[model samples]
Target chain A: MTAERSRLNLRDLLSETAVALTARPARTVLTALGTILGVGALVTTLGLAKTAGNQIVSRFNELEATEVVVSAQSTGFGDNTRSLNVIPWDAQSRLERLNGVTAAGTVSAVDVGDDLARSVPVVDPQGQTEFQIPVMAASPGLFGAVRASLFTGRYFDQGHEDRADPVAVLGPAAAQRLNVTRVDNLPVIFVGDEAFAVVGILADTARRPDLLGAIIIPNQAARDRFELGGVESVEIDVAVGAAELIGAQAPTALAPNNPDQLRVAVPPSPRRVRSDVEGDVNALFLALGGVSLLVGAIGIANVTLVSVLERTGEIGLRRALGATRRHIALQFLTESVALGALAGVLGTSLGVLAVVAVSATREWSPVLDSWLPFAAPVLGAVIGLVAGTYPAWKASSTEPIAALRGVA
Target chain B: MRSLRRSRGAPTPDDLDDGPLEAWAVPTAPAGGLSFEGEAVPVVVLHQAGRTFAGPPPVEALKPTDLVIERGEYVAIVGPSGSGKSTLLHLLGLLDTPTAGSYHLDGIDTVTLSEPERAGVRAARIGFVFQAFHLLAHRSIVENVMLADLYRPGGRDRRRERAVEALVSVGLEHRLDATPATLSGGERQRVAVARALVSEPSLLLADEPTGNLDTATGDQIMALFDDLHGQGLTLAVITHDRSVAARAGRVVGLRDGEVIEDRLVGSGMR
Candidate 1:
């Protein structure tokens, strides 16, 4: 009977403490709001940061190299602003023929008329846009250097090159734009009034900007038909040991157009870019998430302190009723922790909403991806836990008797 | 001690023994009364004990006075307002430490115990009934009673049963689940009594327990105290009413922190 009595006492104390919190719920809720906003702000910021990081990673993948880029610049050829590449076919061929070089490829900036656009988005009333996608056109052996595989049709060969066949492979971005749109063997106009046949559509690559509308062609065809009769630029793909060696001869042959365009490089594997982009995105998320968590802590602290004051008489009663000092402190702190955690949950949900909002509007491929819809909740949960800690601590430190006597 | 004896089934005027028992009311508990070897006793001995409040000018609220209270005795320490009545109660309750001398409760030297130990002793041995009732507004009547047992080890169901039993003892079974705020002034005091007795303390102490109640209600509460005394609990009460003091076995009148009269009522055989 005696043991039963004491046990009942503890249960009653905790229940009563919780009850005390509920009595001034309006005030408690008001205090809790601070934590909510703090957590929400943090989580949403984290979402944006993650998106920015993914954008950067995707950007890196777009620039993924067969060899480290020594430099880059405009092609500077006359009347070629609409051209897709600065690196011409002859320069790439010459670079590839070097002893230590494995292969060579080239890329350029091009403005393709929106192939599938009913209309352009994020533009002014003039019908012009700031969105310019990266376009790469490669020589015959370039595939060997960049390690890209053809999804269906074969990569360009010498016969097509010699005849300047104009058969082109569409990159992932272009393929997505033309998803099941059935444009195989269709005539597509390009630089120098060339008419090209769409051989195959490339899947969307994680690489952004450059790989979006990439158009690949063999060297012979590029040299015979597309070359503007000079060194447009050179992109050399050399062995690791010979990266610096290409620097020696790069200025000699291509300096006229290669002012900064002669890019001597070592290629990165596909896997490296994928993981790197994910890591970058996560780092950005953590930075923003951390800051918001601090806000949550402050919110929790304020609420707790207020509660301590409001419940002063209640605390005094508990003390008189057999509650120890430590018990009082623990009870208040526990309340704080609960509030912080609830706020965290709310904040995380807001963050997920942010990601959803972004996904609804922008067409840019996000670098970091979550599993279909559920990943948002997981991300939110993690952010919430991190943000709720300090608030919980602050809540737990209230002195029981003083807390009881404080006005709500 | 014979004057402190009860007439068993018939409650007598001097049956209640008041001796440092009021502090136990803070707990809604069980076994607040003292016990070690299957028996309980109330033995308070205050020797030259006093308290000083550290204000801008330190106020000596209580004067050193030697006192002793035997087991099963109902004693009323009477005094006028601000005549050190509350101060003496606080000191007896162990809620405050004395600035001088020493005190003993149930043969245990209080001055020598650790702070936490003192708290444990207070929890285990005292039941207090305040003039204001001081019931926690948030908890139900049963919960309030249960709080006194918080330091006592047991399971939930057992504690719950004891809480109900305590409420029944104070005739508050019908309002077991009602919060103090929902109770009337008299009912709240009854709940407070339930909370105090739930702990079954060695000493039942009252600091003007009926001060907030009307005359009839005050007398009813006093009668309730008289009935508890018949059950052999030690009680110490502080009151301004002469009639309230008249109900105790021994009445000690205080004038300016000094005991002016010590009188016995009814049978003073022991």
Candidate 2:
């Protein structure tokens, strides 16, 4: 008899592995669950990190980087003579004419004693509790610069400022305190015996949230009634990427004669903050994904080892039928790798679906790498190969005689 | 002899009228005295082959024994429990190496061959049928048969054709797509036989071929074995049943790891 060497072709090995794995459908699914969850978690976390980071950076750019504040530097003196009335009356128009500036306005406190500004026409003789609300004055363009939304009625316009109209805009909190909810009836509030008509109620402001609790009157009105002199600060809303240039030009534009008397404050660049936030979010999620993947790998290893033990008879029978040790080991290894690859595909699909579902609910755009789906299955196969090594070796080393005799 | 046959609950040689003895009916040397001249070399040759299990006190499972099986011969290795029958079968199947002595298969020195080489020899030259049927239960009958040639060098279609032919020879052509679980005990054994024959090995080694079957089913399997032997396939069956041993052309009685008897029995017709 010619001595013929035994051989196992790739086609047969794969077919045999397929048969073995598909024979028990339930076990196959159960064995693949860990890998599925691990890969799915990985993809979902990565997608959300990118998508959420983009959302945060865009919002930050809108609120922070687009705003520039120019304040008058107060001279070091107990008296207010030198520091008073330094800003031009045409500060809003002067800054707004700049190329990058969207809207600009000047604001100042009226300097009326806080408790003296009462909502009622007559003070109570019984010494009733009083609301100490601070009153401020702003130009018409301040509302636009601050991105203030109105709850009801309209803002006092340039016409009101030009005529020095005694119209007032109440912040939502101020409106609540003064018991004024609507401007349709033209409700009035007495500030130190001067009745001002409430024209609008502020709903929200994007830049300065502190202004939400104060009462705002037209700058000309504040100047005429309360003798408000110097402008405090000019708020300018510039287009994105234009804040730095406007910050540099605003001080000179507002006080060309005394530019040093004005100080410009532009928001710090958002690039560093965006990167830091993204890095933190990505690192946190990636750690979680890695832990999940490790657990999945452990699960695969455990299941493969158990399967090797359970299929000892099959391994022995193959040996008796001319299978070498390497053939037996390769059969098992290929089975696990196939299982992992199939799980990876399923996990990637599930992860993509999860990202889409979450983004839809939150109204955010989902971001994922184009190659993630293609690479996930390969990652899963590598995990499977690693997990199956010891178990395949164990299978290969089983004694055929003992195994066939049902002794193990 | 009558008392022995009655005690064993099996028929004597005289009770079988299976035609005249064939030319291979004459028994060869009982203990290593045969010469290899110009005749076809024996399919199996064991010279003082033995096996011992390692232990604090090593257990000798099989003593040094000499046996030669020629081509197309039907031999039965019969022994009671704990009589080295399983040990000798393991040795003959090359599932374990002999601790002492030498074994030659088709004139190749098997003892000196590497483990992988031994596996190659076993795959190409030996067919085994176990008492448990040893068929992959999940596979179709034809697929189970085809598994025998999975490690052999051949095209898939050719291997499939040979598998179908082997199944047809075992009268299982109709159950080609049926799983082993769907088959009866005898049909399962027949499928196992088909799987064994798929590789066209020189020697068929069956370990307790009918230990799990009823007497009638066992008889059917033995009849199939007789048919295969008539077609000039060499077979060595290890069984504890006297009736099973009585069906072979020669019987080698083993007791406590020693060969006690070697003699010709049933009509060896071809």
Candidate 3:
């Protein structure tokens, strides 16, 4: 015959795909469900990982990134004796003068032997009302360095430190133990034979929470009464991104002559911490997404293969109508790809919704990569293509005569 | 004998020319006058064509046989079950290749053609009407007819137009938008006929076209075939029903794996 060659165009392929898929709406939706769940999980897990990682890193940056601790190195003795690294009494002022240092302070524990603290002047020989509370000597700037908030009264100032006053600030635990609730009356507690006036009761400290249970006295008062010697540790609070700088400079600022005798502890870099956390989170979530996607792909493949088997007569008819094997393959492939792309769109929407819903419930800002929504459909299409490969081939290879006879 | 004598005359390109492409037209030189002899080639020519299925002991399905069918002729192949009727039909439709001999359709050697080339030839020159109707149930009558042209090489501009015309010719114009599910058995067969004719193929091969229809519907379909034959189109119908076979101008009867009888019936007019 003087006829043009038989061929199938892209438009016809797409139209045929549409007709085949829409012919059974319920089957189409059921077949696509696997991909939807898979892609949805992928997006949700990835989004949640990013959002939670951001929260953790921001909190870590706030506290760990800004606090630096400088402690005197012990001389490898059995006791808590330091290596003569004298942090001078003016150490707080010296360290605070450095750049990025918000506040600085010195703290030392006073050794009290067989002495107990009591709310009343009588020394209870029965020891029922007497308590053996550890005593702490701290500079006035310690309150600021630790970010402590007061309960009612004010903090002991430099005047009290210089004049060697007996006024004391009780931690919450110490106050409760001593039966002192209000600081407005300036309650006094007797330590051994000394009556120290309670100046303030601390509600909370940001850095060292242990200070909440100890009875804190001025550095000079502790030195004068309890014979306190070398300062134990210096706490310095610096600005964000300045912990390493302040940590390196604080030891020298405290003891310029024997700076080597002081040990500085700086928090790990925020960038490293953030990456480590994100990497762990991404790996775990990506694996979950990958597994779900694999299951989705298998669902597509299994359903497509079953469809091909069920439609052998149709395939045979097409072949008899002058469709080449390639035409048959393309038709089925196009159908599956369309199915996958549709599922991808649905999965992405569901995933984004899940992320937003969870974030809203938890009161967190949702985080998602902008490209995710755009790429998900394409990825789903690719999965469909791969999954449809064998089925399409099976359809294309069906023998026209055998299939028409219903033998295949 | 007249057709055989007339086929010897060399037909010129002018003799091959006809009216503008329509739903039905008797092709003068369907294969573009591929025969260098310049003579009118028969629509089908078989030289010892046969099919055999491989088995522990090979089974000869259709023994080597020779057959010829000329243009504008209506021929019927009838036989009981397992009579090699299906083998001959498959061979003629180009659905199966012959292992014993050669087949030439519309002056072109079919055995040497590649699979894709055979498919192209089938698309352009042969239209098949299955007894089952084989209409796509999900599609409208018009769309089912239009699909006949989907594999044909051409711009899609006039495809729907040709399909509508074919449907109209088959008296299905009013039911263009109706699906096969909504059609009777006879109406569906007519739709199948329209789809087959939409391509304007050189040969129409029907496999028991009335097998799935009632007597009245079968008669109606046969009457449609009579009209198509009156228009000088080539037709080949395979069936086991003697009544259906009696309508064709020529009948070839098969028994087992060989043709047992070939005869003319009715007016035997081409």
Candidate 4:
């Protein structure tokens, strides 16, 4: 009989807890909203941070694993500055002969005698000075190295580079500035009194983003017309895990006697980037989640206290029914924990939904913690248990006679 | 020492009862009540039991007094307001401790029991009904009766069956699922009585059970009490109304925290 009674106590407790909560549905729901918002904000922030961080680290790893850049060190300022170890005109061919080298290309800035190239024969009557376009000379492989995509016409071939024909391609920005949208018109742009026929307009580039705002001409043309020096920079793509090795070998390959004069740049190791990004993302959102949880805890405490005050008569009745002080305290604590558990379950689902929506809108793959949905409700319940301590104690301490006086 | 004296003499009411014999409106319960075999023990025995309030004035709420009530007896403690009728009831119900003297309930020394132990005794042996009917507004009449069983050592199904039987005994079986809010004043009081009876306690303690009802409704409730008393259930009612006191088999009157009169009604010396 004693065992059966004790077993039924749990069922009785739950039934009584449910009755108490349902007695004031509006108050219970409003009180639970605090935990809902807290948990939802926490989970949503976590989901977004992981998704964004994953994209950044993946891109960083991909670039760091395969690409290396070698630039000639500048000895002085201005157009007269001498390159201590200028990249050889045949830098691409030399680097390609090395193991693990997939592709290589050369690029050099064009010095147009301190004058900007203009498509118009004369200046506009309004005297607009917004079209100061910069120009660059590129080899054929530079287009492949930089991953450039053409918008119109065609890229200049090896035939044009070998004959030194003054053919050019305009970047999207440069093309807009020159009022040349299509290559069908065969537009001519003068570079320091020499006219070059525009062959193509580039839409975008992967490596050399700065090229979007400049014009490109054949390297042979720049060399013959302007007495251009050797290539200013060589960009090389190698197989994964070969960046450091190839970075060391490319400089020596380009300038065997002056390898120290060239600076080879490769991205930082992948391990470092992953930790840095993860740390930043976790720290930022964790604080926000913590603050939200604190506010939720306060809300639960406040509501539990108010409930204890309102149910003083009920407490007295239970006491009269032979409920000990501990029993009273346990009953109230159970009600609090039940409220928090409800909020946790609802909040976690809402948060997960929000994450899916945001990730879908941003075109990112959502990443969620595997155990968070199950753990969150338990955490909320624990918070409720802690928060209810004072109120439950106050309830249990109520003098049975004094409480009954109010009821009578 | 009191228990030793009682054991040595084994005195019945005919030998040396304290209260004087008198005639009253109600009759005593018949002999052959549900008698416990072996030895008969009074349900309540108070020897110089008194309660004092800890106050600026140190008010003595109940004066030291001796009282005894045997099983199957109907008793009423009658007094005006502030006469300590409620105080004496509080002591009898185990809701408060006396500042002076010892109290023995069901032949067990109660003064030595802890608060929780007192609560356990109350759960197993005493049933209380109040004037206001104190039914939980959110629960049905059946559920209200079932509250008593939650504290008892039994299966839920058995407890529920006992609650249903108690409600049927109180003529409230048809209104089992009706919440207190939907019940009339007299019906609500019946539910309270059913709740008190559900645990099959040894003694029924009621304080002003008809204080809040209309005279007609109050009379009906008193009639229900008389019927319960006729069935060999012991009852103690504390009230200010002489008319309510007239229906009991015995009456003890209080004035200024002291007992002024004690009397038996009808042909009642068991």
Better of 1 and 4 by lDDT: 4
Itemize residue pairs with steric clashes in candidate 4. Answer: none
Alpha-carbon runs more than 4 Å astray in model 1: A1-17, A52-141, A146-310, A324-326, A333-408, B1-42, B55-57, B151-157, B266-270
User: Stretches of candidate 2 above 4 Å error?
Assistant: A58-271, A283-287, B1-39, B155-157, B268-270
Per-residue lDDT for B171 in model 1?
73
Best by DockQ: 3
Q: Model 1 chain A — which ten-residue stretch has the worst lDDT?
A: A1-10
True-structure Cα RMSD, model 4: 13.0
List, residue by residue over A144-225, the lDDT tens digit for candidate 2: 9999999998998999999999999988988887778888887888787788899899998987777788889999998898
Candidate 2 residue lDDT tens string, B5-104? 0111233454222111121221232122332333556878999999999987998889999999988799999998888988998889888889999998
As a whole number from 0 to 100, the lDDT of residue A251 in candidate 3 is 82
Residues B1-270, candidate 4: write the lDDT tens digits. Answer: 011011113334532221111101011222323223224567789999999999888999999999999877899899999999989988998878889998887766777887667776666667888887778888888989999866654425466777788888888878999999999898988888888877666678988988888889889888888888876678999888888888898999999999999999742444
The C-alpha TM-scores of every prediction are: 0.61, 0.66, 0.68, 0.65
Q: Please provide, for model 3 over A58-168, each residue's C-alpha lDDT reduced to its tens digit, 9 standing for 90 to 100.
A: 676577778888888887677754546467888889998999999888888878777899886457676578889989999999999999999979899999999999999
Model 4 CA deviation exceeding 4 Å by range = A1-8, A60-292, B1-37, B155-157, B266-270
* Model 3: residues with Cα > 4 Å off, grouped in runs: A1-5, A60-268, A271-294, B1-37
What TM-score does candidate 2 reach? 0.66
Which candidate, 2 or 4, would have the higher DockQ against the true structure? Answer: 2
In candidate 1, position A200 carries an lDDT of: 61
